[model samples]
Target: MPGDAARPHQASLPPAPRNGLVPSLERRRLQAYLLFVAMDGFILLASFSAIAAAYLGPGGDFAGVRQGAEPAFLLLPLFLTIALYNGTYSRAGLTDWRQAGAKAIAALAISAALLNFFAFFAKMNAEFSRVVFTAGIVLTGAVIVAMRRFLARRLTARWGRGAVNRLVIQAGGPKFSLPDSIHIDAREHGLRPDRADPASLNRLSQYLRNMDQIVVSSSRENRAAWAEVLKGTGLHGEVIDEATRAIGAVGVVKHDDIGMSSLLVSNGHLGLRARAMKRVFDLTISLAALIALSPVMMLTAAAIKLQDGGPIFFRQRRMGRGNGFFAIYKFRSMREDDSDGARSASRDDERITPVGRFIRRTSIDELPQLINVVKGDMSLVGPRPHALGSRAGEKLFWQVDRKYWQRHGLRPGITGLAQVRGFRGATDTEGDLSSRLDADLEYLNGWSLMRDVRILLRTVTVLVHERAF
Candidate 1:
């Protein structure tokens, strides 16, 4: 009954005669939601068992299951209600794991406080160990947060491509064709905006009605007219400037006169406190790491010297935060004369000494960058710095079409999300560099101390497994 009205033209057609539109209502999305609910139930049960075992003397069976049935029943519904109130189910609400974990912890804290108050009022606080309830709060919250992250990643990975929905764009102008230009242009941005004829407005409207979302792009002069046309068809749409849409869809924002203005007004600005906290975190972590890894750095320097009669350390001028040039420090992993401009190092680089190869593979060659981190020229986690004029030869690299220098917004890092994700070596093409930049932007947009810690932990795991160079 809820989505019956939302169904398109089903009432006009003879539905299998028994259940009109009922089967259509039970779509994959509905099934996914149901699956999520079941998963949440399983997480709750598993978490309760774990907490009981940890705090309830290990042998305290659920013999009082019937006696506690009413309380448990009330608690589950109440917890879900609180989660809903916190916007845990909303799109754009729980994207980051840190936020999701915080929300779960907050929800559990409130629920526990309320449950305890209820127990106190009912004079049954003595019946259960407070420790058991505390453990349940922590365990259940952790499971829910982790499961939510797992589900989010699965959904993003599956739906992030043009797999679930198809977008239809209707653009009529002297400069643009219906779908061909849109298809060619949008593909670069990982979008597939199919073209629809303006004359076929009815078909376009029907398509929009069935699609998950719709976006409209037109010249500034024609936006109002297009908006009216789309609204008349009873469909919601976003009107973006045709030029801006074209450029942004390709994921390239130039930092020129107009581009800089747009970015300044755009929502990409991280506020002052975030900037300050990030800087403080960089300083603290880098200083501590430099102190801790001093011995390793010394041994690396000695090893490089013993292996070859070359400089013990390598220093290359690299672009840092705000496009400032700084000399990046590394344990000299290749012969000094091997350097030929800003070429990327290959796995089997002939100039790499045997000792250098081992250090590079294990990432010990990057240890000296901790000094750069302490010197405030770099961060513990940010975009990896690139050498000046690094893309002189490759054709694909020439068409990078990105704000490559925007990576200088934060200090260059010793290790970053991109590096840990195996995008660290031999970025010989535009596609590879673009992917790395995307990961860097993702990190910048969602930077937090917890995220930094997680990245470090993951970096250690990758190091142990020799996953990257």
Candidate 2:
């Protein structure tokens, strides 16, 4: 609700041709995820049995074999974790067998390395069977990946024939060229995802009772307004664009809709592996920082209470990852009676008490944001959170650039490239926000753990500024 407009009224979409190959993969994605886990478990068990038989021989101790296979269960979690870690599982039905197997194999190699690393730490490497580790895991990974591919082909083909959800794309005008094959393919599968007119969206519910998806071409007018309107309809909305860079950053699958290669402009961000790694990083740092800095925080809390008996923490509704609104916390650096919580603080503001100025200057006021990182509302290093009334001059933040909101692709952070570049305070010029936007987009496109670490380390030296500090 902070600088954003109220949700638009629900509009009925125009009548659309409902023909798709299976419902949109969005609805059935979870079912396929579970299936892969099961298939992997089966394949791993079978491969282990074969390897065990050869290693133990036909007459070797039968009871020992059963107990021996018990340790192999550890490999199941490892397999699943590695599969998830590398995105072999999360990106289900989006890739072909070759790509899937390649990713799976890479995951297998990493899992093997992890197994050895843990084994070495536990001093179990000597007792662990090397032959089974190499041969059995290799065999298991091959069979599972191949089986995974076969199942993907089979399920997609099988489900493609059944009745599925309908997707209707509305282009601004009729001049856009769309392929008839798109309608034909959907018709063949009993789904009706065809091109429609954006003007008649007010009648969407009347024409298509079971419409599951509403897609908008990038060329559509007032995209934000239309998106908000459709949001009230309770159907998932996607903006399909031909721009590869914009699409690739947000889209998970490159869908050839009609005759055009369209990108699904949502579900973009750090993939499964990166998110998992970042979460681990967030927890490690947040918990450690909280423990190490408890005394400092306690003193700050007391100082604020004694200063004017005001609340120590200031919580504001700020935008987060996925364009979601969350309460961002900070040690209050303004007077408790300041009614304009949404406004940016001017240099030498009267609302800032003496203690507030020092904390803000030293960058200690933002330290409480570590709680946001641990709570998963933010990351340790990212685009800084902006208040609802956050603006560049008279215009609100999102209004400055069409792609500005894309900065929400990652969670907001306490400090970022923009801050280190000295663009942290009030933005009076358009160029100032653009400079910050450039840094944000740059961080997103080339994000890495090392880059995150470097940014975090770099943040310490630049936390204090002459003017703002």
| Top of the candidates by TM-score | 2
Please report, as a residue range, the 10-residue window in candidate 2 with the lowest summed lDDT: 186-195
TM-score (all chains, Cα) for each model: 0.44, 0.63
lDDT score for residue 280 of model 1: 82
Model 1 bad stretches (over 4 Å)? 1-269, 337-341, 396-398, 464-469
Model 2 Cα lDDT, one tens digit per residue, 288-380? 999998998899989988999989999877766545467888888888533324466777688898889988888889889999988888889
TM-score of 1: 0.44
Write one digit per residue (lDDT tens) for candidate 1, span 1-469: 1110122443453222222111221144445545655666566656665555655455556764333333444467666667657745443322444555566567667776778788889998787656556666666777888887877676656444221332334343223222211212221222112111111232233333333333444344444444433322322234444344423332322323222211111122243345557778878877787788888888888888887668998887765654445788878877754232456676667778888888887888888888887787788888888765466237333136334534555667878999788776776667788888789778866778788878877888665324333
Give the RMSD in angstroms, all C-alphas superposed, for model 2. Answer: 9.6
Q: Give the TM-score of candidate 2.
A: 0.63
